[model samples]
Target: MDNISRRGLLTGVGALLAAGSLGVSTASARSLALPASKRFKMSATTNEFFRHKPLWGPRVMQSFAFDTPNNRLFAGQLRSETPENSGDLTLSQLDFSGNVLGHMYLTGFGHAVSIGAEAVGSTSYIWTETDADTTNGRGRQITRFPWQNGKTLTSASVTKWKPVSGASVYTPAVDQRFGRLGVRHARSDGMYINVYSLAAARTGDFSTVLASFKQPALTAGIDFQGWALYGSYCYFWEGEAYPGEPDETKATSKLWCYDINAGVLVDSFLTLAGKSLTYREPEGMAVYGSTDGTARLYFGFASGEPGDRRANLFYRNTLV
Candidate 1:
């Protein structure tokens, strides 16, 4: 544990910190057991249009999606969170008031992390890439950019990443709801639910919607990070890698709920414990709406312990 004690335990848990606009509590927000201490008032006001000054520092932001008609918010930053940094895919674009409209650098690719975008038809916008380096064979590709001049609508193609039939293993996670482009792969052993067919304009075809299940028991860790698609169900999180046993118990975690249209697997939330405590790795997942809009399922755990500085936003509040 060197690197200055793992960056002083990721700067005492605030690893790459940023928060400033908190008021999270609308009473029973939507129920999934919402009482973890209800209090969400955070404000440092650093949304400087999605700030990015680190040329080489806190870069572990594996996945992020939200490009509602250019209102922007498309992140996939990685340089070190291992998985060989998955080819260091660094694509950025932020604007829903968080401005930073451009940022790109995609090399041959390795940890292209998981990303899935949609807007296919009235103009076109399809982005998909999931290869959290399950040693690399976990390569499931999908690329078609052109929301408005981003170009390569179907020239930067890639679609050979397969594994989705009766089931066996098709690891893919990082869903963004209704705008559509969901994924959570694994079968022949457990956990499965694939959705990606931007009207089938063609791009590594995927539309199994749901498969293999008998009860919440899907486990295949490391790269199936936070996934969400409330309402019909599809909330995911799984992690397992105790290899050398130090990097936070080699990373151990779990949280599942899939019914994305009745695919099955009601609930399972064994976050982390009794094996050497470790829950600091459950990347990006957000759901909060209810003024009558209804939406709950806030997740973003990433703690390295030591000094615990904040980054454990877990909330279920109803998805049953």
Candidate 2:
């Protein structure tokens, strides 16, 4: 069980300082010019949220993001503990040291495949899948809501957005550097990623999009685990769990880099970053935009047995 704490009264000043460091005004309404995706190499690893069980289902963590403004991380897992044929979710809030400080429940929200966390001036918001489908319990729309500790929110309580008309199963990603938000969605035609201004996206005005591109079809070999949109590059995380007899050498994950601006598949690499963990299954992805120009691409994994499943977060930080 995690201990939840109330914030201090002096958050306003901290929030403003955080916003300045994040390169934003009260609202992130402007875009910043950054360099192109370097097709960077996976350098080192940081074990964030290692072997931590979530509040709901003790389930495998599916997605996560860094709440830079508040200096915390928000992680989510599917709520399949009950036989409701539901898409409810449980989100855990953690400090940098992997200590869970709080939690919130999301009803009728999809498998939490990917999540985006944004905050300004002490108020934090979560961006993820919502309006779940009854059949498979996947999300039909992307939604946003305030981060409330110890609170359970339903899909009806928040507004949902459909980036592409008639598109379903939407998972969102946020890059605060340029105030960008992107969603990977499936439509009748095919799967696509649409990027928009975070400000415009919040107000339900998706017009004047920044970038729209088709995601590369997954090859037969790679298992699709998670994805993230950082700057002009969209990254895909792929890896399967180990078989009954676990082999660390065989337990490997891959990161695929697709340059959205160039409209090309930049490069990809099969990684054994956390190969030592048992049942090492790759899960969610998020990008941490640092002011130093090193955009850290972070991802998560599920390890251990079913009843004792835990979340492990790793990142590829330095560019080659």
Candidate 3:
């Protein structure tokens, strides 16, 4: 297939793209079928990235989303090692196997707490949680961008980005088929999952809260990091803080599953023990598969050492 640039895609579509917003139906709650722990075995780890770079690591790879239509994976890199107020956001474009293809550096967006991507025809839209600073009680500032493909995002593209009306949600996972945005919010009681209509929310209208429920097991202080919604299931990371460990990498990581439509806890298990990877501080997660029934899950690690050649370990496992 020839590469079709986003600009060419929009130009070719004309008024066909004008068809707007779809109505959202409420998801019914039901019992979730848990997956067996033995199903996920340790898989291969990819090459290391951002090794010991002061400007990057400590918390380099934070969040990622799969652009299935484009056959690309987009990852959010938080520049936590940099000075405060100096900018701490970057987006990396990658292949299915986790190879960096391009990078977009976003300045003044604060820390990228979460990210969701949507591809319209060929144009790509990125919705992200930049920071936690509240304006009018919106817990975090959520921004959306229509990226024009380039080696790097132009200043014009950055300027054209707009804000989405959501507050306090840290994780944004896009279900393009249903046009819904599955997000995770922290509450005093527990971790809550809410699905909003993407079509309605884009127009600054949020009448559709597709699904809303709390998962008490995601207890307070158990950091809910990476998240991805696939089919009827929502997969997320629980990088709960470890005892006597200041570095997040030392903390163990686990994967939790929820049936979004059924509104029930399906499965929870620790990450597979990879040969070269320890699955520590797993942050960003993404699901990629082909139509022929082949599927794999990808995960990004937060910390490790360049000396051990395991500084930036990212893993992929067959879904079977």
Best by lDDT: 2
Please give, for residues 197-249, the per-residue lDDT of candidate 2 as tens digits: 89999888898778776555444444567888776677877667764435655
lDDT sort, best first: 2, 3, 1
Q: Evaluated with TM-score, which candidate comes out highest?
A: 2
What Cα-based lDDT does every candidate model obtain? 0.39, 0.69, 0.49
Give candidate 2's TM-score.
0.83
Clashes of each: 22, 0, 0
Give lDDT tens digits, candidate 1, residues 178-203.
33344444443333345553344245
**Candidate 3 lDDT tens digits, 176-292:** 644667666544433455667787656655565655654324322345456665655666665532222244344456666655555545556554333233334455676555431
Better of 1 and 3 by lDDT: 3
Q: Which of candidates 1 and 3 reaches a greater TM-score?
A: 3
TM-score of each: 0.27, 0.83, 0.64
Model 1 ranges off by over 4 Å: 1-58, 64-180, 183-225, 228-233, 238-254, 263-265, 273-279, 284-320
Q: Give the TM-score of candidate 1.
A: 0.27
